[model samples]
Structure formats: structure tokens, C-alpha cells
Target: MHGCFWHRHPGCPKATTPATRPEWWQRKFDGNVERDRQQMDRLIAAGWRVGIVWECALGRKADGALIDRVEAFIRHGRDLRAEWP
Candidate 1:
């Protein structure tokens, strides 16, 4: 699992580009996203289950159900996804 901004988690509030330097921020963010994608791809290909748990998904309201989703991915290799309702 990874943080939203650093890993470019979809729909994350913190994943926004800085307004002051839009171009630079976009490039940097794009690179971060690309790197994460490549890393996930490699891990999956190597038989390791990988996932991204966005920060937004860990909000107060979603606390209880998150564990269930994580357990499912870890135990059964079910689709590794966790997001806010």
C-alpha cells in the first residue's frame, strides 16, 4: 500500500499538482505515477501480490471494512483494491 500523493492514487485530494509551478509539478507527478505503475507491474509478474490503499480510503467512516479488504487480498489474492465509499 502507498500514500495517495506520492503514489498518485486515483481520486486522492493530495494528488493535486501545485498551482505555482504547474508544468514542473505535472512532470514530477507523472514520473511518480509511472514509476509506481512499473513497480506494481514488476511485482505482480514476479508472483508477489501488490496493492494501493489510498489515504482517503482510511477515513473514519471506512476504518472497519478496510481490514476485511486487506485480508482478502492477502489471503486469497482477490483484486487488490481499497477506496472510500
Candidate 2:
């Protein structure tokens, strides 16, 4: 699964959230998103396949893109598969 590391385990060695202030954390999250976008673009430009797994896409819902998420994973062999609580 491909996703911002922070969203996976915030404060993990591979992830982090700004701690100086709450707003800093928000900016940090935004930066992570932008960085992830750039990384995807770079990977695509390099001819590598990229699949995104968003934190919110894992929920079962009456009206949602859950099927799309499954299809993406099945067809692409990758996903931003975050196990949200």
C-alpha cells in the first residue's frame, strides 16, 4: 500500500507529525500530502506503477467508493491500505 507514512503510524520511525504546535502538525500533514503527490508523479514518470491507499477509503459504507478501493488494489497490486481504527 502506498500512503503518507505519518498516516500509517504517526511518530513511527518511518513517520512523524510536527509537535511544536497543533497548527504545525496540520502543516506537516499537508506537506506530507504534497510530498506523496510528488513521489507518485516521480514514480509514474519513471514508469513505475503507483496505487494510492487513502485512510478514509477502508470503511464499509452505504454510499462510498469502497468497491473502487478494492478494484484498485486487485488490479494494481498496490494500495494506500491504511488500517484505520
Candidate 3:
């Protein structure tokens, strides 16, 4: 599971920048995004299926739909990449 802020989850409210040290935070976030991309690329090249479950998707409640989606992905997903909402 990846934190929306650290992983730079697009359109996520949790992905916010701190008021202080904006430049430093940007650099850190950029590096994190780049590293994640590189690792994902390597995994894909090695014929591994990749699935990313964002923190926002896991709410306080136990969502049946989310669990089902994850189960489906694990059991029968054939795509190169899959990400949760």
C-alpha cells in the first residue's frame, strides 16, 4: 500500500505539500515518484504483474467492493498495471 502523499496519487486530497520547505518537499516527492516509476518499469520488464492500492481507497469501513476488486486482480487480472481508487 502506498501513501497518497508520498506516492503522489493524482487527484487525491491527501497529496498536499507542506507550507514550509516547499522546494525541498517537491524534490523529495519527485525523487519518490521517479524511483517508483523505475521500480515498476523493472518489474513489468521482468514479467511481473503490478497492482497498486492507494491509501485513500482503504477507508475506515471494510469495503466489500474494494476487497472484491483486489481479489479479482489477484486471481484473474491480466493487465500490465492495476490501481485502486
Candidate 4:
């Protein structure tokens, strides 16, 4: 699972930048995003499905339904790419 802050999940409140070092943080986040994209691309090219499960989705109080969804994806999902809420 990827941390929402590090992966910069769109519209996620956890994806926040520190006020002290805006430029540095942006560069770091950008690098992380780029690396993730490149890795996913490579995996896709190798004929492997990819799924991103944000850390926030598996909260401290994770439920059975969410676990089932993840399990289902791993077992039978056909999509090349998917992101969990």
C-alpha cells in the first residue's frame, strides 16, 4: 500500500505539503510520483496487472468488506490498473 501523502493521492486530505520547505517537498513528491509511474509502466509492459491501495483505505479500523475487495482484486480482477478508495 502507498501512503497518500507520499503518493499524492488526488483530493486526499492526507496529501499535504509542509509549509517550511515547499520547493523541496514538491521536488520530492514529484520524484516519488514519477518513480511510481515508471514502475507501474514497467509492470504493465511485463503483462502484470497493477493495483494501488492507498494507506488511508486500510485505516486503523479496517473492515472485512474492504479486505474482501482487496482479496477479490488479487484473485480475479482483470483491469490493468486500479486504485482503491
Please provide, for model 3 over 5-82, each residue's C-alpha lDDT reduced to its tens digit, 9 standing for 90 to 100.
Answer: 999999999999999999999999999999999999999999998999999999899999999998999899988889
Clashes of 2: 3
**Residue 72 lDDT in candidate 3:** 95
The clash numbers for all candidates, in the given order, read: 0, 3, 0, 0
Give candidate 4's TM-score: 0.92
Model 2, 1-85: lDDT tens digits are 4443554444345455455796977777777767776887788688666655544434465434665555655587553332322
TM-score for each of the candidates: 0.78, 0.44, 0.95, 0.92
**What RMSD does each model have against the real structure?**
2.7, 8.4, 0.8, 1.0
Descending-TM-score candidate ranking? 3, 4, 1, 2
Candidate ranking under lDDT, highest first, comes to 3, 4, 1, 2
Clashing pairs in 4: none
Alpha carbon deviation, residue 59, candidate 4 (Å)? 1.9
Residues 1-85, candidate 4: write the lDDT tens digits. Answer: 8999999998999999999989999999999999999999999999999989997888678678888987888899988988888
**lDDT for model 2:** 0.56
Identify the runs in model 2 with alpha carbons over 4 angstroms from their true place.
2-20, 59-85
Per-residue error at 60 for model 2, in Å? Answer: 9.4
Which lDDT values do the candidates have, in the order given?
0.70, 0.56, 0.95, 0.91
Better of 2 and 4 by TM-score: 4
